[model samples]
Target chain A: MRVLGVDPGLTRCGVGVVEGVAGRPLTMIGVGVVRTPADADLGHRLVAVEQGIEQWLDEHRPEFVAVERVFSQHNVRTVMGTAQASAVAMLCAARRGIPVALHTPSEVKAAVTGSGRADKAQVGAMVTRLLRLSAPPKPADAADALALAICHIWRAPAQNRLQQAVALHTAKAPKGRTA
Target chain B: MRVLGVDPGLTRCGVGVVEGVAGRPLTMIGVGVVRTPADADLGHRLVAVEQGIEQWLDEHRPEFVAVERVFSQHNVRTVMGTAQASAVAMLCAARRGIPVALHTPSEVKAAVTGSGRADKAQVGAMVTRLLRLSAPPKPADAADALALAICHIWRAPAQNRLQQAVALHTAKAPKGRTA
Candidate 1:
């Protein structure tokens, strides 16, 4: 499967595409960052992000999109901007009927480096080795994006099976009872 | 000016439109909520929100769009969902070139009832009176959406002047030099 991973941010969003499957070697299709000036209006910045993502989607045409889920952050402003960028990424994928997955930072770290507590450099090193690249992707966000794609590519099949199991169980569940 | 106000949420997003100028009576053009099932996938839910906002923009064609600025919340997940929804609202407006403004909850309360700490009922009552409606809009989100529009309509002119003043000052400032 070809997965496009997005590390969503307002000023700099990372985009990377990887083609791979579980228990197999992966190939790097593309990697880049979409940047908007800090001084730009919020709407204009968002427009630029939307356009950038659209361009990437058009060119790479990944079957799956992985986005870094915005979790708790001490800086609410930063978190809000990240969440906004994430939603845009999801919307872009949804509009194209591409399946999207959200992976937590820890999940990506653990999947890429075999440790949830792995630092940026460790994850970068692992991603470089996994993709057989001579050097790590520039800018931490780019490496992180590739990690997200790798995580989803590795995790999606198991997740789908779990979901199917849950659905089947629910289908067999008893009817609601009143007190 | 005609303003479309959005109170963004993951499950139920409140949308309202009003037309008026500062120091003049306001008219309510539309009010409703866009709802998504909780069990739906995040990407699908976000797409629903985008479509809902796009439909509103097409139908009402408001000159300006006002979105509730999400603030820090104790629940990180709730805050993230809200921020995501808010981004979709902004994207809809930005795509249409409709000027967008974000109003904080306190700002909306202050604009409607002359008190930043005004309770919801008080704001609802004020919105009812301002709009010449017999009853407050159903669902607190709906009322809050109207309040956002009212706040923006009253504040935009002054805000524009302040922005212009800052722009002028920066433009006339001395060039780079050692202090």
Candidate 2:
């Protein structure tokens, strides 16, 4: 399956597409960043982000989209912008009928580098080796986007099975107050 | 000026439209809530919000859009959802070339009820009196939306002048080390 991963941000959003399946090699389809000037109006910046994502979606045609799930940050302004960008990514995928998955920063780190505490350098090194690229993608956001795609590609199969099992169990069980 | 105000929420988004100028009586053009099922996927819920806002913009043709600016909440999940919904509202307005303004909850209350710490009932009562309605609008969110529109209508002129003054000063100032 091919996945498009988005590292959502207001000033610089990362976009990367990877084609791969579980237990198989992956190919990098594309990677880039969409940037909006800090001085631009919020609405115009969002429009630029929306247009950038739309262009990437049109060109790569990924089956699934992965976005970084925003968590609480000390800086409310930064978090708000990230959340806004993330919603735009999800909107773009939903408009195209493409399923979207959200992965936490720790989850992506663990999946890519085998450690939830892995730093940027470790994650970048792993991504370079996994994709067999001579160099890591520029601007940490680009590498981070690829890592998100890799994480989803690796975790989705197991997650799907777990979801199926839960669904089956719920179907067979009766409504109860028990925890 | 015509203004569309949005009270951003995940489950129930309040939308209202009003037409008026500063120091003049206002007319309520529309008021309603857009809802999405709790069990629905995040992407689908956001899509519903996007569609709802798009429909309101198309129907009302408001010159400006006002959205509730989300602040940090104790509940991270709730705040994130609200922020996402707020982004969708801004995006819709931006796409239509309508200027967008964000008002804090306190700002809305102060503009309508003459107090930043006014309660919901007080704001609702003031909205009814200002709009010449027989009763308060249903759902607190609806009242808040109208309050946001009223706040923008009253504040925009002063805010615009301040912004223009800052721009003029910057344009005439030299790039110097002095503050």
Candidate 3:
């Protein structure tokens, strides 16, 4: 499976593509950041983000898009921007009918580093080692993106089974009735 | 001027269109809400919002788009959705090259009712009076949307002057120098 992971931010949205399935070696296809000027108008900034994300989608053609789920508990000042950028990334993928998944920060960290509380340096180091790169990707956001993709790839099997079970249960149940 | 206003929300996005400049009789061109199923995926909800906003834009051909500015200080559970919806609204307008303006709730209330802290009912009543409607727009969100458009129309003149002044100052100032 191929997945695109995004660490969404208004100033610097990190995106990385990883190709693999669970219990297999994953390959990092590409990783980069989409940047918007802080001084630009919000509308124009969103447009820029959309354009950048669209370009990435065109180039990568990943089957799934995984974005860091934004939580309002973060820095109040930056949380909104994170939510907005994530929305754009999700929209771009959903518009293309690519399944979109949201993984929390801790989930990403835990998947890659074996600890939910792993620091940025650990995540960077782990991503570098897992991808067989000589150095960690620049800008912690890029490393975080790769970690998110790795997490999604590792977790997809169970998630897919759970989804199938739910679908099967719903399909067998009576129509239009609450469970 | 014609302006389309949006009060962004995940479940119920209110939209309104108003026509006329400041200090003159204004016309309520349209007012309504765009709804999305709460159970739908976040990405699909955003796509629905984009389609809804685009439809309003297509129908009204508004010269400007006005959207409510979301603040994280509000209900924590809903603020993120509001931010995401507002982002989609802004993105839709920006993609069409329509000038987008964000008005705070207090600003909309103040523009119509002469008090920033005016209640929703008061703002709705004023919007009814300003537009000469027989009744307040249904759903407080709808009224708020109309209020936003009215505020944008009323504020445009002063905002334009400020923009022009800033532009003039920047042009006359030395290049590569901070203000």
TM-score of each: 0.89, 0.89, 0.90
Question: How far does residue B21 in candidate 1 sit from its true spot (Å)?
Answer: 1.0
State the lDDT of candidate 1 residue by residue for A1-179, as single tens digits. 88899999988899899998999999999888888778866776777788889988988998888999887575766887898999999988876667778899999999999999999999999999999999999899899999999998899687745644543444323221100
Candidate 1 is graded, for docking, as: acceptable
Clashes of 2: 0
Tell me the spans in candidate 1 whose CA falls farther than 4 Å from its real position.
A158-179, B158-179
Regions of model 2 farther than 4 Å from truth:
A158-179, B158-179
Worst 10 residues of 3 chain B by lDDT: B170-179
The recovered share of true contacts, given per candidate in order, is: 0.34, 0.31, 0.36
Writing each residue's lDDT as its tens digit, candidate 1 over B8-86 gives: 9988888889999999999999888888667867777787788788888888898788899888675766888898889
TM-score of chain B of 1: 0.87
Q: For residues B1-179, could you state the per-residue lDDT of candidate 3 as single tens digits?
A: 88998999988889999999988999999999988778867777777787788788888898788899999988999999999999999888877767778889889989999999999889989999999999999899899999999999998677845643543443222111000
Among these predictions, the greatest TM-score belongs to 3
Q: lDDT per residue, candidate 3, A1-179, as tens digits? A: 88889999998899899998888888999998888878867777888888888888888898778999998988999999999999999888767767688999999999999999999999999999998988999889888989999999998677755643443443222111100
Rank list by DockQ: 3, 1, 2
| lDDT tens digits by residue: candidate 2, B1-102 | 888999999788999999999999999999888876677667767888888888888889987888998987657779999999898898888766677788
Error in Å for residue B7 of model 1: 0.9
Candidate 2 has an lDDT of 0.83
TM-score of 3: 0.90
